[model samples]
Target: MTGITISKGATVIMHFSIKLKDGTVADSTKVNNKPAQFQVGDGNLTESFENCLLGLSKGDERTFELGPDEAFGQANPDNIHHLDRTKFTAETPAEEGSIVVFTQPNGAEIPGIVREVVGDSVTVDFNHPLAGQTVTFEVEILNVEGNE
Candidate 1:
């Protein structure tokens, strides 16, 4: 099997780190001790991030800096929603940092991260979590191959 570069339909195993413009590490596979697997153009990654991986081989590492728009896009105020506190349970407290999943019409569960906990209310942020922030990624292309 020939190893393909970052083309559409290619499956890639990658270890990546994302840092904010303020130099804070927002996410990193290195810290989690696990790699991520995704197909190209799968919407799991931004186009800019995918573009950066194009033509890279195994063991190759590249870093990219992207603005908010190029990354997760600006954080939309509409992505924030307040829910009633009664909807929470003792096992799933309505507290900041707790994640809640809502069922969509398609029956897919979308997770919203809790942003605030207040009396009779819980604020949930449906944003990508990295939105509204400039970010840098240190990525290592673990593997790639043709899928179609």
Candidate 2:
């Protein structure tokens, strides 16, 4: 039998690493010693990211570079929000460079990074931390199982 290749509906187990343009390691499954397992066509990964794995067989290794728009996407200006200091409690102080989760009206929790804390206002960025940045993605396919 031929080895399985990654495709829609395939369950893939892989080791992956992401690095910034400056060569800073962002994340790595290999370092954690935990291979990532996910089914293709699931919302767990972005379309662009999934595209990189398509047609790859087990034991295959590949590296690709993604632009801002293709990766986390260009940072949206509207995602930057300023909130009143009064809204934060002592337990949840809005410290600069800290990440805090804000509950939306729909009960969805969204994480935002505190950009600056002024006297009475705190600037929060709702954009993904990697947004607007180019990144290098490296992957090694450990296994690929097609849907029966």
Candidate 3:
């Protein structure tokens, strides 16, 4: 570990910023003064995202562009569902553009965005909000701990 570098099983501490094609920042670790720390090859990050960190060392900065498929992935039509409005009460109205969390049979909580609301029906999209969009990812490696 003379010169630390990011690789499989390595622990990494870094700051990252994700932005859309229109330059709207989707997320950033620097904003809260808290850097992200994770192990390479872990399920915490997408494979493509981890690939971008490979070969990076402390103090190194990089920027890369990822297509929709490589980032959040293309939106699946099956992820869109229409539900009866009766499911939502006055306190939890299914208003357009709002997000709601639904529980799955396996006890997983899935968040869905309300796309449209019509008479007694609501269209909700379970796909990630960043799905189907190109994105720019920037990162600054702060620390790298090899698995040696």
TM-scores of all predicted structures: 0.80, 0.93, 0.95
Worst 10 residues of 2 by lDDT: 85-94
lDDT of 2 by residue, 10-103 (tens): 9999999999999999999988799999999998988999998999999999999999988999999999999999878876789999888889
lDDT of 3 by residue, 1-148 (tens): 2369999999999999999999999999999989999999888989999998899999999999999988999999999999999888776679999989888999999999999998998999999999999999999999999999
On TM-score, the stronger of 2 and 3 is 3
In candidate 1, what are the lDDT values of residues 21-84, reduced to their tens digit?
A: 8889899998978999999889998788888887887778889899999988999999999999
Better of 1 and 3 by TM-score: 3
Clashing residue pairs in candidate 1 are none
Ranked candidates (TM-score, high to low): 3, 2, 1
**Model 3 CA lDDT for position 32:** 100
**Model 1, runs deviating above 4 Å:** 1-4, 146-148
Please estimate how well model 1 matches the true structure, expressed as its whole-model Cα lDDT. Answer: 0.86
